[model samples]
Target: MSFDYDLFVIGGGSGGVRAARLAAAEAGARVGLAEEYRMGGTCVIRGCVPKKLMVFASGYSGAFEDARAYGWGVQAGGFDWDIFKGKLEAELTRLEGIYTANLKKAGVEIHAARATLSDAHRVKLSTGEEFTAKHILVATGGRPFVPEFPGHELAITSNEMFKLDQLPKRLLIVGGGFIACEFACIMNGLGVEVTQFYRGAQVLRGFDDEARGHVADLMRDRGVNLHVGTDVISMEKTAEGIAVKSSTGHDASYDAVMYATGRVPNSDGLGLEEAGVRLGRRGEVIVDAYSQTSVPSIYAVGDVTDRINLTPVAIREGAAFVETVFHGRPTSPDHELVASAVFTQPELGAVGLTEEQAREREPIEVYSAAFRPMQTLFAGRDDRVLMKLIVSQATRKVLGCHIVADHAGELIQLAAVAIKMGATKEDFDRTVAVHPTMAEELVTMKSPTRTA
Candidate 1:
């Protein structure tokens, strides 16, 4: 069939850009991509990049304290939100430009407008333009979901966090997820009086119980007024910022309230259902392992499919889509043992099943260690780190690896490679430990803490 292009990709996110670029540059197919907002989408524009920078900025307060204890003369000054925000905005602009230039370099036509499905192979843009393509790809990601509550409009989500006019003196964070916990810690470290309320019994609900509990304790120790099993009953705007009534029957006023509850797939109003594309209950585009949707010519990836929502996973899904469709390789993006990190005060890095999940599946041995690392110990801080490995008794292979400490994210990435390669307990033991290092515990744990 004659078409305007070989592939028309809606949403110029990491996934969409990767697919469009690969199809055009590698496979020599004509491609076009449309993005209503920024070219870099959520991760580069708001999610990972800016959040990590905040993590870095917030850690300096603790670092200065540690430096003093270590005989280094260092004094921490007040954080300037204006200066930091200016630099942050500049960096985002630079990144967005790179994303645009790369797509154009790969010969993908870029549209700075929202695109919706007209039919199985047709796309209608907000600019009142229509294009027919041989195939269509939807890579529109997700958005922060804030529940309807009194004065909710006054509350900000993560999207507005990076763009705040000034850092709030008192910040109220709601939600039990990583986003909430991370921001609570970030604001607290930045010298804000941070109060966090999670309706759940514990924050980071889906993670390892021990690791999450340890994090919650440290957050409280680090001056985050964390209240679990509690939520805001209502919020009202007042001259003195936000007046919040809590489920605990407490009344307080905060400079700002931020909701990090969750995110919903950006699948609505995209005309997917009209085009015969199946959508899940959460509005996630339903797709096969290869990312092809119900309609033959339409496919979806990234958060739109509600698969692994990480940026790296989305990029892989995009590449796999191009491989399967354009290069005829029939690739399916791997989703197993994906390592992830919660960028809380003490980060939690995890890969594979939790001890809870492993024990339910099969007999397992859990090797765990909790100790004060040399660096923190030397600085006279009571900070502790956790290293745990869940191993299958039958196969002796490591079923899971979880680390809770500073820079756990960096550590888990290397550990993930070993776990992904099917390394066993003996294999890890055989590798000599790198002494005087926090991560050496991963290999040096000689005994199982518990066998189930």
Candidate 2:
């Protein structure tokens, strides 16, 4: 009947912190949040920020090489990796402090320890202190998955990759997911010899087949040894270095091996069972549309739900939950027509449905445009761009939009807004094209490549 706090949140990541801050500020509720690790969570510390910085850093080598074409007469000078690492470390420390300050500003009590639910409405911290609340929220997020192979222990996960003492001269990446691709690009572009092996026939299995093929071609041309439909069976450390034996009858050597296979929900060691909370397959917390878990007084959000593993998606879910439950505004994410981008060299941005996914329904008209971007013409680069739109035959509603080229991520944002608004193919034609922009191809495609 009585509670010590209005809400007790586990995990100080994006979802947990957002819920706590909003509950205190909007609902005037007393909130307590605990995080065993850093404050800013994966995105700020190990995932997005650091990864993007590496992306930027890696891109410079290419830029420098391309400078000569622009008559800049650039030459390679001795480069130091430690300097970049030190700068990135400083930036991470600053970001962590900001996350801490944000929580304090919202008047939420912060506990620097892991929190486990002891009962339906009670949470116990590692320090043996127990807190009771009317509601408890779990947002512990997820962890990278490294499979067991012969000498699996020799491989490192993404978390370890972030803290490597020295960058490997030759790196072997095992997996075809976004993390693996992003890291492969980063290291290879930075002059590390990288060989990426994927068990599936394609690297980005969910993306359009043509897009995957084009990206694979570009990666290979950029000096990445990409192996698809191959699996690692064993690894051995030789006097020369690490040797990898593949199930597809391939052998390779590298300074280090990274397994970016996938990630599972961080639901372990949290005593969910002790608290009567239910978890679905892969140990993801079973939550309702409102993010309330099976137990009425308990809720879960973020990667722990395993619904949408993106950082922005997690933040939106956390905000929506508070709005619906505590702030008197009912809201939910549609999760459809969501735009996403892969940060490979040329990049890939997509929204709505894939042509393959759209083909299962009634016949759809698919329009595609591919050409060298105008910028590349003047810049004297041979890089090309591909843009596509999938439209319903009957309704003419744009079913999907995809792009593979520079600024794809930036371009997809507006397309996502259009898709979210249910804009049709005619709507794109009605809008005036931005002259000479790569994205204008999306609106300018006059004919369907094929009707299915």
Candidate 3:
């Protein structure tokens, strides 16, 4: 079959851009990519990058307080939403330009419009260009999902939060996931009276139980009105802003309400089913270990496949896709023991399995330490931190590692390497402790607190 390009990628997200660049420049295969909005998709444009900036920006309030305790005359001024928002938008624009520049440099054609599947090996772009490729890659990623309800339009999603012109004086956040709790902390630190409602018993539902509890406790202690076992029954608009009725029988009014309930894979209206591609109930594309779809020429990776939604994971998946299809090397993206972080202050960084998850599948031992970090204690704040290890009883390998402290995200990333290589509890014991550091707790805990 005559093909205009060897690979045609839909959605120029992390996965698509990586795949397109490698296949075109390295593998010497003609590749084309199209994105409806910006070149960097969600991560660079909206989600992780901007959100982390806000998290950092919001934390200065506490920083100034800590400085005062250290005998420094640090006075915190009011947060200026306009200045921060302008800078954030500028940074995102810079990042988007980099993504586009890289794609162009790699010799991949970029379409500044939407593209979708016409068939197994063809793509139709919004610019009225139809192209046939030897292979089609779907990397459309996902979007924030806000459930339908009465007056739902009065609330915004995480997407809109970044674009809000002014910070709300009173903000109500819904859902208990990492996003919800993170924003709760961010808003609270930014001097907003933040209230969070989650129907679940706790926030961070899938994380280590003890670690999540520490985050919840600290969030509440740090001034987030966290109301678990509660959810919004309805929200309405009024002069005060959003009037919220909680299922827990609480009624309140807020300047803004945000729903961070979840996200859905961006697989709809792409003509995948018509092309004989299989999809899961959540509209996620069904793919093999190598990311090949039901049709030989059609493939998917990243959030579109509903795999690990991390940007690095998506990039790895994309590289694996190029290797398997174009380079003739059979490779399946390794998803095991992937590390993750929840950006809620004193962030949570973790890898492998939670104690609950490990115990459900096998015998395990848990070691945990919860204490106030020296800095926070010095600042006269009762803020606490936790470090835990979940170890497999049978193999004695560290099954999971969780940390709730400052820079947990950066720490967990390094620990993930050792855990991924199957580091055991004894191996951790063999390492000497780094003194006077929060992470030293990881090495110094001499005994298991419990076993299951």
The clash tally of candidate 2 reads 0
What TM-score, computed on C-alpha atoms, does each candidate reach? Answer: 0.99, 0.97, 0.99
Q: What's model 3's lDDT at 263? A: 86
> In candidate 2, what residue range of length 10 has the lowest lDDT sum?
374-383
Candidate 1 accuracy as TM-score: 0.99
Output the lDDT of residue 384, model 2: 76
Q: After superposition, how far is residue 413 of candidate 1 from its true place, in Å?
A: 0.4
Residue pairs with backbone overlap in model 1: none
lDDT of 3 at 137: 94
State, as a TM-score between 0 and 1, how close model 3 is to the true structure: 0.99
Compose the digit string of candidate 1's lDDT tens values, residues 276-370: 99999999999999999999999999998898889999999999999999999999999999999999988999999999999999999999999
lDDT of 3 at 418: 86
Off by over 4 Å in 2: 377-380
Maximum-lDDT candidate: 1
Candidate 2, lDDT over the whole model: 0.87
